[model samples]
Target: MQRRNFLRAAAIGAGVTAFGNTLTRTAMAAPAQNGPGPYGPLQPANANGIQLPAGFTSRVVARSGQQVAGYTWHNAPDGGAVFADGGGWIYVSNSEINPGGGVSALRFDADATITGAYRILANTRLNCAGGAMPWNKWLSCEEIDLGFVYETDPWGAAAVQRPAMGRFKHEAAAADPVRRAIYLTEDVPDGCLYRFLPTTWGDLSSGTLQVIRAGTATSGSFTWGTVPDPDGSPTATRNQVSGAKRFNGGEGLHYANDTAWFTTKGDNRVWQLNLAASTYELAYDDSLVSPGTAPLTGVDNVTGSSSGDLYVAEDGGNMEICVITPNDIVAPFLRVTGQSGSEITGPAFTPAGNRLYFSSQRGTSGSSSGGITYEVTGPFRS
Candidate 1:
């Protein structure tokens, strides 16, 4: 039987999902477990530029170049994640600006009200999409040659860079709790899908980096090949490797229900990989599915909802957060109007799962210098 079949069987027949002793029996994404219908049409957010489903409300939590409570909110805010704190949680966001780029964190109360904001990591370059770890930390990635992934403490503690994860135009990463592995995506036209098998689970200091070779669509077997040089040297690591499979601008990554989901911006496709068997299936392809059916374009950042649905942020298209159902039907979940050229990013949820958070990489100005982080509250799935 195919790997996907095995996963489905284990999830249904045994009433649990398991992945290599790393994962415990847990709920599938909220959308998949509770949904088959798309979200309702969007209602105008305001002249400040945002749209969302009825009953849903949004508020700006942080903005570029602004000072909040003695800390400066950095420019070009990109990928981010949320971690549970005492009564509330901490939201850490990446600054995609060069030279001065870094990561920032915000404190919120149980009511989703912002408490304070501060910078966590600094003096980096192009910190882009990153993933939250099972160990309660954030991996901030830089989009540059020999770029490294930084493990940052969400509480403004110390940060250490991990080059063992491989160096290239890094885009995003997702950790498979069951497999104890970190899956990564690159942002080049011919980027690759990779995974880092840490010498010890939950430790990013040492790991073996390998890239995946694609098989067929929706049900292809996958194989991994070692990355010659994880830290790009005289010659960039990606260019030095041979026989490594390439993806079209690999972008956002997330893990749900024993599967690793990633997006490819070049072709606007999202792939679902079964971690145990290392196999993948195409989840959504905009090119194959016309705009009339699914208006969302330029698929970039992705986040999974407890309802088992996936929310995708557009990098250039309608500037909307599109929802992808388990059945693969697509519809607009949230749209940012008046921001013609900017993209929506950093979609995350608080630990209690009551609030949804995201960012506009570029605000109404449509320039990198202008960006805003937002939080939305509604009847989110439990």
Candidate 2:
């Protein structure tokens, strides 16, 4: 077996031994019950610019261009996921810049301070957003032409970039172990949602790529239209792209409850794909999605909370972490402070869901030290 697969199996086996059942089985057996509402609005941070609720605190986990493992830091750090390995924190972060900053495999002590950071893959182009694997590694994806997905070890070695998944402008990826497949997002005009069915369950290299078909039109015959078109006329025709889309800038991806939730930076919409049923549904249309007094806007990245709620990071507009409750009410769960006018991305929860971590990139109106990571501690009432 490949070292990656072996490590994954061993981790799953250990989890099974500890829990006495499969992770998904336990999750489905007892659905998460809703807790109380969020703990008020976000509290502003001090000089560090980290923000959380009243009871919670924020600290610097790591910074850009910082030296570690004999290599200097890179610029434009983007999507990242947290993994638990024998009681340690393993952070897999991406560098979104061209000749992509490369993936960073960092080990943190119990206090969440960076102990070591090393390059996992080098000389790659535009390593954008990625998701965490169930067996405990990170799926690093390239977002450039003919982009590919690389499955890397938590320790930053033994890497393979799988191109069979697709060759378009790939953005982000989310793995669904229950269905033994993966969902991918493409950043292009009239961009299409895709799924990869692995030939072997839990193995990512061998898979078939398929695009999503939606709208009232039949398959392979749908067209794309601009958002908020003044004409109010809908265009109908297959808007498929041979390689790139004119406007669809696909970005964030997350899988939960057998469905894949994704976001498009161009249109500001959150879509869901029912994997088991092979159907598409609109979870939120940013053009029309209004949560409480705050309408959903400028969504960048998204992740599932332990209570089954989805927390979306807004990269534009108000610069806040918005939570979409089970009832479809969108509100500001955490408003970012310190770095005003900065864009927030990557809102991932720890394995235990006791803490939430997010990153903020430099924006148009503010001067930032590259980016900042924050930890929010609370009940995280979904």
* Winning model by lDDT: 1
Candidate 2 displacement at residue 358 in angstroms: 2.0
| lDDT of candidate 2 at residue 96, scale 0 to 100 | 71
Candidate 1 residue lDDT tens string, 199-315? 999899998888886543445787888877787787666666576777889999977557787899888787777766666766677755643555667999887765555688899
Q: Give the per-residue lDDT of model 2 (tens digit) for 44-153.
A: 66445555567766665656655655555555566777777566566666777775556776666666666777788777877778877666667778876666788877
Provide the RMSD of all predictions against the true structure, rounded to 1 decimal. 5.0, 8.9
Q: Pick the candidate with the highest TM-score.
A: 1
C-alpha positional error of residue 280 in candidate 1 after TM-score superposition, expressed in Å: 1.3
Candidate 2 local lDDT, residue 98: 73
**Steric clashes per prediction:** 12, 9
After the best TM-score superposition of candidate 2, give how far the Cα of residue 236 lies from its true spot, in angstroms.
20
